[model samples]
Target: MENIAKVCSRLIFLSVICLFFAQAIIADKPDFKYSFGCLDKGDYTSNSTYKANLNHLLSTLTSNTEIDYGFYNSSYGRDPDKVYAIGLCRGDVKPDECRSCLYNTTNFLIQHCPNQKEAMRQDEYCILRYSFCNIFGIMDDDPVYTQHNVNDQSGNLDTYNQDLRTLLDGLRNQAAAGGSLRKLAEAKSTGINNKTQYTLVQCTPDLSQTDCSDCLLSAFGQIPLCCDGKIGAVIFTPSCNFRYEEHTFFGPVADVAPPSTNTSVADIAPPSINTSAAKGNDGNKSQTVIIVGSIIAFVVVVVLIIISCIYLRVRKPREKSESKLINWFIVKKV
Candidate 1:
């Protein structure tokens, strides 16, 4: 019995130590939120000029100090070897963080997709993509990616969905009406349980108002299919994305003054999407921490429960044997 108790105590102590280390690990290295899509379009030879142009273009794409608006579009080389790229940072991201996010994305694409002529990557804060053809000013919605919270809301889901839709619709309009510099909007609304539904919608600034609206609409339509009843969800497409959460998940947005009324939308220099960059926010990190912590905590609890059950089972038999011995002694004495 003593041995069993000691063993159980050791196990419980070890489990606690493991739980502490697990949480430390998670805090030290938060899981980065990102997705990669390596298109089957085509591949370039290692020594080909296309590869050289791609290397040169991506290497220097974020080095330009002049572009602080978080939208970058440029082409390198000419003809068949020309590589077009676009990088877009979240509107709320600072210029330096935006550049850093994009720089990391460029490295990611090159490392992960390697020889693919067309590839795209979306980080929590930014997106980076490249192609052989002119992807400029064109809205591509395919190859969509969606992520939702694992936990569901407790209140009436019908009311929650309706509130979410209303919030997204308003944000979509606000983002679409933005000028060529930026097309992004964020707002919050009260939902069931009085939980605040925070939402953000964004489109590449190069897109026309109509194009931006259409792209966001397509993304919104995907919510019912992908995230019904979930407390949080995000849908990503090539042209646009929308995210909603029960808690605040975005940073303070900078005030962007409206463009001059005389400036024609067509006259604005069209920003293109080829290779772009955005930085991650604290919301993604917190979400990752919560999810990881919950899983680790649950595992630890289960292990402790099992250990406790074994200890109780082992102690019960010893107690029964001692009781029998005491009764036998009393009878013999009598």
Candidate 2:
């Protein structure tokens, strides 16, 4: 019994230690998924001039100095071998993540879309596109790729979709009207069941306002075809991309409050007092609350695991002893 108790205790301790290390490993890694479009305009040979242009363009896009605004566009080589590539990162993505995303995407494009004259890849944090023709300052919405969460919306989907559309429309206009260096917008809205929906809209910075708007609108038109009735979805294309989900998936940025909708102005009114000075204070309070809540949750989980370990250790021996007793009785009778 003493030996079993020691072994069980060691096993439990090792399990808890393993769980901590596993969680740490998972937290350090970023989960990224990407989709790409490859144009069949023409194929290049392994050692062709086009491949050289593509390599040069990708390197330029991912250069350390060119990632400040998280958008880069450049052309390489000449004539038919020329490759025009564009890299655009989500507005709220950190500079390091932006660079990593672009670099990973470049490698993916080369490997998966090999020998293609035109190819584009879209990840959650960034986009990478390369083409033989002039892709700069132009909007191309064709050949879109749409993805949606597997879960369907509950409650009134009409109300949910209406709120989603309104939120995305405002973000679309705001993003398209952005300055030349960056065209991106993120916002949130309250929908049915008091759920918060976060939406991100973005276009390549090289596109003109009109072109960007048109491209986004075209992408929006496909929501019904791909994302209607879903709780979350992403519509991606070479020119633009839009995403929305119930959870706040992005870090804090210059996000606009949702427009005053069917509710009264008083419902959304600001406090009469000057709260600007308290904004930092309020942020600190929120952070403190989150930290405290996390600690509480962690403690609860640890306690539950310990209880489980004790219960298993106590019960396992009883079951084993009962099985041995039954076996011994049967052998004596035989």
Candidate 3:
């Protein structure tokens, strides 16, 4: 149980960090393109047919876009049609990270669950799940985790809850109304505690608006489990997910306007620092300084070694001559 807890903490830790860091980039920065995926793993018996079919289905799920996904046929020889699976990457993750994550999750799920037909793996940038039953189009929020920071409530929890409700409702509307390829909603509001809380609510494009709202609503309730009085938390389910925190978690949206990095004022740096790209010889000079400093230090060490050897050679002979003079003086005194 302790090991499992540790594993859960470590595995789920990245999802939390990603949510926090997403806000690190200035909104003015260009947004990058990405893809997403989802799956429902239903329970199944040990011996079952469709084993070959399951393998084929998984193989047919060719990886694509910024999101790469695959289903590994688990049964080595036995045909178990009883197995079902799905893999979804974040809409903003790079294709390379998505691919590596998919590959890792596939291998991990097999090792962690063994022959079990029902299992799920939620990661920092993607999700992987498999079961025997068909779960598409259905909304599931139960058995999910909603977590937040641990701090004293500034005012009443109810007031903050109401604020969250109003803001999330607007975000929900906006996200559900997203395009066919992506569905995401994020907004911020000032709570009674004089703190700014940002909430991000989203779902896989495959799910209906009803499913998305229902999932977000249900996840809202689970926030007490992992994040009761904290600043933020993430409640993720098989199909939909939501997160709320005081800090920004998602990076600025990538510029969709064709190979452009700078286009608008909002693409400028954040309030804290200047984020412009380094230019010309100044940056190059700094790099050269580092290299030149290292080489000079090496040469100085070699020169010091030669000087020390020369001093030692000269000093050793002088010391020997003094010793012989002392012996002659001792003999004359006798």
Candidate 4:
């Protein structure tokens, strides 16, 4: 009995150690979500100055605390040996996850693309890219990479396509209109058989609205060739990208209020209002009252119109039935 107890205690201790190590290994492991392009633009020797600059630039990418919004663009070195890098994370990704993704993806790209002067790698959460040329603010839609689920959508293709297109188009517009920090939108729509189609669209915030729109539109145009009726798909470009699936694949999004339309003169007044605190407060209160009253009046008018239309519609059907019965009686008498 003493020997048996010793053996059992040993086994339990060993199991606890094994469990701890297993969890550690899992936590440290990188997610191998690899989709990359080692472009044919150019290559550098192992000891080249460009390689050193590239290393330095990429090293700064993940370490910078100022890039909490998830877009990083920076350059190192000068003239012929300069390197430019861009690291972008999905809008819904938290800052720590974004940094971790960029770190892993940068390491993966370095291993895979070696001495290439231009290379781009995309994982599930982020995109890491470095180029010999200036890639900021400019839109590049070529060399689009796409991935899709093997299972095809089991529904009406036309209806599915229409629903996906509508969702993507709206998301594109919303993302394009985003500010310089981040340009991204996620939404869901009911498709064929009432399945909810989840979608995310995004652009590099550096791109102008027109450029972003064009880049996303170009990505949208590739769905036919790449994903067709797949239940899920992701299309990637340097400037913009989009993804869609039948199931939710993104995190919660913070709601953004629509731009207010009350643009009275006082609302746009000069900065001198800070000097006149009492006047400014009064002006703000007046504007608030006017805006609230306007909204109430608009709602009242719309409600009255809707009630009148409903009454007319219901009365019209009854009047038509009564007239038909009267006409039939008159014909019978004749």
- Highest lDDT model number: 1
What's the TM for model 4? 0.66
| Per-residue lDDT over 297-319 for candidate 4, one digit per residue giving the tens place of the 0 to 100 score | 65565566556556666776789
Question: What lDDT score goes with residue 172 in model 4?
Answer: 91
For residues 1-334, write the lDDT of model 2, one tens digit per residue.
6765776677668767866775564343223357787878889998998898788778766664523556667777889688787788777765566778899998898999988888888887788888888887889997898888766888998888788888888888998998665688888778889887878899986689999999999999998998789888888888899888776656654332322234321112211221111011234245446755765676677677678778777888999999999999999999
Give all candidates' CA lDDT scores: 0.80, 0.74, 0.54, 0.75
Better of 2 and 4 by lDDT: 4
TM-scores, each model vs. reference? 0.72, 0.69, 0.55, 0.66
- Per-residue lDDT value at 204 in model 2: 81
Weakest 10 consecutive residues of candidate 3 by summed lDDT: 265-274
Query: Tens digit of lDDT per residue, candidate 3, span 164-221?
Result: 7788788877777664334677666687768877677777654687777777777766
Q: Please, what are the lDDT tens digits per residue for candidate 1 over residues 1-334? A: 6676677777777777877777664544323368999899999999999999999989888877745668777788888899888888888786788889999899888999988999999987899899998877899888899988766878788877777777888899999999777899988777788777778899998799999999999999998898898878878898898887766667766654434455332212223333233443656566667967787777878677677869697778999999999999999999
Better of 3 and 4 by TM-score: 4
Segments of candidate 4 deviating more than 4 angstroms:
1-33, 254-334
Q: Count the backbone clashes (under 3 Å) in each candidate.
A: 15, 0, 26, 0
Which rank order by lDDT, best down to worst?
1, 4, 2, 3
Judging by TM-score against the true structure, name the best candidate. 1
Candidate 2: residue 77 lDDT (0-100): 80
**In lDDT terms, how accurate is model 2?**
0.74
Every model's Cα RMSD, please?
8.1, 12.5, 16.2, 26.6
